[model samples]
Target: MKFIISVDCEGPACVVGNAGKALSASRDYNFACREATLEANAAARALFDSGAREVWIWDSHGQGLNLCIDQLDKRCKLILGKGFTCRFPGLDNSFSGVVMIGYHAMEGTKNAILAHTYSSESYKNIRVNGQTVGEIALDGAVAGEFDVPVIFVSSDDKGCREALTFMPWLETVVTKQGMGRNCALSKHPHMVQEEIYSGVLKAVNCIHQTKPLKFKSPVQLEIDFKAVSQAVKALVYRRRGWRLVGPRTITKKIESMREWIC
Candidate 1:
């Protein structure tokens, strides 16, 4: 068996907003990266112990270079950099299952720590088939296109709830409880990592029962930009299958999640 672990930097006791903070190595950002790496290491080690032949860890946070590479479990290969057409780069039908760690909820989610769909600055809300979705749903649907199920996830309490709302059978661990966009009551890092290790083992054991998170074909994707200027900028070079539906919104029709473009 083989597995992929997607690690984002905002949920494992992290509250930073953008890539600049991560690049600058601010105290909070550095701590967030270390915590995320520890959690990823735990998940990777769990997958390896559970009979996975290959484990790939993807640093999926802002700038796509958030995790501490050297500190990760050497047993698994790391995926770095970003700007690929596919959300989860190198993801294909060959992987057995997907695991997400240190993820938050969608933009404008009440009391979700550092919540945003894809970009905190650019997007106000992203809806697929008329339901608001976070990275968990969007990325999960992308995996679903390849028949791969997201078996495990770790995030804040609200983020876990969002994941459950999308896929009730997903195994989740809550690393913190959100008090506001930048405030969270976090658990001890050691505790969260331990839970992630065990939760991953359980999730992989029940992988056969979990289903891929797929949306019906010809999906209606609606994106509400944070500002009208952002939407206007998008309309300047409108691509195929995209339309300006409102002053701050753009709509698109896609046959699959893999076709998500705007």
Candidate 2:
């Protein structure tokens, strides 16, 4: 079987502060990248050992280049760089299941480590079908378009719980429990990696029991921007069904996963 693993940073395992100082190119970014890569490598190795014929690792974090390519498991093909239209690039119906690693809670989640939707600077919150969502839910919905179930996820305690609301059958590994936005009681990096390895094995073993999560067609996406200026900027896409709902919010009706990502 084949699987696609989508890796992000800023979960309990990483993320030291706000977006500017915590993302790529910053002084502290390397630490996050190292941790993320370790977790991804662990998952890949586990999937391979469990008889997965092929594995695709997509670096879904900042700049889409955060994973340490040299340290990643050589058995898996890695998707790096940016400019891809799909949120989870190279994903399709061919994969047996999807796995999300190093994810966090949705925007406005109290005590969730570095919580935010797509952009911490631009978006304050994102709602699909009137329910707040994070990257996990968004990407999971995209996977649903291809009839692929998201079988595994690793994140903070809250993030895992949040994800369960949308995908109750998902196999989750909680790397930490958040004390505050930038503080969490995290397991050692080595320990977290070990859990991820085991988690992936269990997920793949039970992949057939999980089912894809699909939202109703003509999905309504409501975006609340952090500032009015950000809302104004997004309003430029008004012609594409983006309408101003409030001074700092906009809403759009997307017909398909392709439109949601684009």
TM per candidate comes to 0.94, 0.94
Best by lDDT: 1
Taking all chains together, the TM-score of candidate 2 against the true structure is: 0.94
In model 1, residue pairs whose N, Cα or C atoms come closer than 3 Å (at least 3 residues apart or on different chains), thus clashing, are: none
Segments of candidate 1 deviating more than 4 angstroms: 14-26
State the lDDT of candidate 2 residue by residue for 1-262, as single tens digits.
Answer: 8899898888737455544454655555778888988898999999999999999999888788788899988888989998897777778798889989999888888888878787777788888889888888899999999999999999999899999999999999999888887778888889899999998899888888899989998999988888998898888955677899899999988887656762
lDDT of 1: 0.86
Q: Lowest lDDT 10-mer window, candidate 2?
A: 12-21
Write candidate 1's Cα lDDT for 1-262 as tens digits. Answer: 9899998888885454443343225557777888889999999999998999999999888777878888987889888986776788889999999999999888888988878787767899889999988899999999999999999989999999999999999999999999877677888889888999999999999998899999988899998998999998877766676799999999988888987642
